[model samples]
Target: MFDEMLHWPFFDERHRALRALGDWADSALDDLVAQEHAGGDVYALTPQFVARLGEAGWLRLAASLDGRLDARSICLARDMLARRSGLGEFAFAMQGLGSAAITLFGTPDQRERYLRGVMDGTRIAAFALSEEGAGSNPGEMEMAARRDGDAYVLNGEKTWISNADLAHQYVVFARTGEADGARGLSAFVVEADAPGLSVIERIPVIAPHPLGTLRFDECRVPASAMIGAPGDGFRIAMSVLDVFRSSVGASAVGLARRALDEALKRAAARRIGGRALADYQMTQDKIADMATAIEASALLVYRAAWVKDTTGARTSREAAMAKLFATEQAQGVIDRAVQLFGGLGVTVGMPVESLYREIRALRIYEGTTEVQKLIIASGLLAAASHGN
Candidate 1:
């Protein structure tokens, strides 16, 4: 059903070819998912998953000729990955997210040094921006990067970071003190094993992921490692988010679509008072809602991707709308799926149950639903105030 979406004007022949991502993910990802749920280490599996994606040539899509990412390709790839395995999706998304800074703003030397490893899956990359004081409001982050001759000395703590302990390198943002709040921040590529850096603690979340806190005690990187000019971290981070936010929505759609498919299958199989659950008007209603939400989410996600790919304009409003609507609605859709499955829904190993956990985080990350609302409203007000 999702493959049919490629026919929309939002996509082209190149985009349609990406449907092959789903075929590969569906077949290759299940055994690995089972292994993880059975207590295999998630962090341990990331490299393998990434390596597989790289070997299969999927990771190559994370890059581009003009150094500009294709938003539509990204969204489609994520949709397929999330549908098959949340952890698989995480591995793929982080590659794009982690390297996005370098791809967008780094010097040629930076790109040459870092990007090939990412595309080949020999090294893992992470984006470290969130801090204890700056999850929603990044401007309040306290980490500082002090210029020290030929290098910058970093000292602070970053929490709730993805790929924390496992990533080979991180693109870290810290205050360079050019100004207060977000304006003062700068981005640098820091190796995971840098002398003064350590993975402080691994965080356990509702889903299986490599999340942790990182501490930088006088951690240093060469001055040449800075992604962009001083005080450009905030802009660079926002630009990266603008590129990936719509892909986040596409991931949610994938999760919700999987949930909907599971519910539909269960409805056809489960007997209720001598009739299959699908025969009930109540069950039909739930299925209707789930399908509608999936359709709507896919529409918003692809529309945002289309706008980004076509206009070369900033997609703040479109991406926020897509992320907000798709994530919020997918939550409801998955809950309905769980409801349809009864006890099996809550069972830890079940597909719908796993999806239930996976979908919850989508609402919170990649700019929360509240943040998206603020972004959308702020854009409208800004445009209206100028009479645009």
Candidate 2:
């Protein structure tokens, strides 16, 4: 619907190519969904879905040759996939997030050992940073990793982990130093089959995928498994989030666009009061608001991505703003679509009903809307203080 934005200054030929590839991948989404449904196991279906993306070479966009992430490309990929299928977007996002620490901070040997398998979809990856008590505050984490003679022994639990039981390796963060809060945390690559590592329980969310809690009981990994320095875990996590957060906004924008499209089609075709719903001034107003919100969201999302791509500095403020606005607004747009559809909206097997469920978790995960506001406000206050 908003094809003009594709030609905007923020994007280039490569992004267009990526979008084309996404369109090609989307052509198979129905079959993919059918296969996943038939299998009736989200965890098992994930690898097959990822393998197809890898075969199609779309997963390569998750990481670049120089080991740096391209925010614009990631945003475009998520935007396109989310529009077609939420599961497709999830698969693409986890592949990048699961190994983001290694891509950004791992040694050459670490990258050589993990990145290749991840890119080819031979090995699944997961990021384990959040604990039961530390979903939003990493500083409150209790997971411990003690140094041994030549390895680190880890003991603790990570909850709400995506690809938990299915991942071959995890980028696990745990308290390692004597310092309290974030400084005590360290990041390590812990294999799923590690002696003391096991899935504690599977977590079922409204929109289901492979999610679960992991427990570590004296899990030991080689000293070389550490991503950076002992106290670098928090920084690594934030850096990775800085890159992916804008893409979350992009995905929101995609979802909003799809909602708008559905609303428009319904308004034009559905008859009401002896005329199509589009004839009503109130319906027109709703459509206008949805379109405006979607466009503004797109601008903010891609602008954040563009800034990150052109400048190496972390776009924390921009990313936060984008994610906060896009996700919040997308929820409103989808709700409006549901409203426009009336009883049909909530009916089982309806597209809008499915979308209504899918759009919800975006606001909670990665970072909640409340957390994004705090990040933005803190950044502004810091800037003002510097000016004074």
Kindly report which residue stretches of model 1 are placed more than 4 angstroms away from their true locations once superposed: none
Off by over 4 Å in 2: 35-40
RMSD of each: 1.1, 1.5
Q: How accurate is candidate 1 locally (lDDT)?
A: 0.91
Positional deviation of 142 in candidate 2, in angstroms?
Answer: 0.5
For each candidate, give its TM-score against the true structure: 0.98, 0.97
Q: For model 2, what is the alpha-carbon lDDT of residue 287? A: 92
Quantify all predictions' global Cα lDDT against the true fold: 0.91, 0.88
Per-residue lDDT of model 2, residues 99-125, tens digit only: 989998998888889988888878888
